[model samples]
Target: MPRTVSELMTPHPTVVEVTDTLHAVAQTMATQDVGSLVVAEGGAVVGIVTDRDLVVRGLAEGIGLDAPVGQLASEELVTVGPDDDLAEVVRLMREKAVRRVPVVEGDQAVGILSLGDLAQALDPDSALADISAAAPDE
Candidate 1:
């Protein structure tokens, strides 16, 4: 089993500027086939935006797509280092009630560790692992 986040995390995760519009964020997510994006400012990770944010906080709230993504981005972001222990990361995730955490190296986002990554790496036989491993439906 992978012992550290670096071993299981999805590296080179898609990133977007905080000033990017919701429409841009949505397009990036669609193009990248990712549910979450690391929001950066001046090359530093500042926040994270998820597909859920687009719907619940943007569309449902009647926020126009032209609005900046920072409006819906979770600014009080939680992060982890690539070398952090997987167990500790899992604990932090549960405590923070967050599903995804950006892995940073001196303010630069190197990767993203997600619940799906944990499930797939730590328990390959689990249902979540199976689902996470399955290809996305077109």
Candidate 2:
């Protein structure tokens, strides 16, 4: 059977408080080489902020890095539970064009799942086999 979200998720994903400065969040992302950060309040996930959000929403709007991350965070967060199937997670990602999704438990973010992680877990070799099998015989 394919692995579930809990099997593939990165536990204890790096987080940023809503009150944190954008510059600080950016620094955290840069240091960790992650594309998104879960925004938490009172240990509960309230929103999400991404590198794209920083560039498109902040820089494009002339908002300084010193501005609070909450100003640019997306409050309508789409999340997955740890027990959710990986296939469902992948489907959601494709449908939303989002690269990262928080894995929540009772509204608290316990992990994160990224496209790269899914790709690694699913393995492209299976797709290659399917494609080759469908090709016409020589």
**Pick by TM-score: which candidate is best?**
1
Please provide, for model 1 over 22-107, each residue's C-alpha lDDT reduced to its tens digit, 9 standing for 90 to 100. 99999999988889999999889999999999999999999999999989999679999999999999999999999999999999
Clashes of each: 0, 0
**Which residue runs does candidate 1 get wrong by more than 4 Å?**
none
Candidate 2 — what's its lDDT?
Answer: 0.85
- lDDT by residue (22-126, candidate 2, tens digit) is 999999988887778999887789889999999999999999989999899886788999999888788998998887899999988999987767765576456
lDDT of each: 0.94, 0.85
Model 1 root-mean-square deviation: 0.7
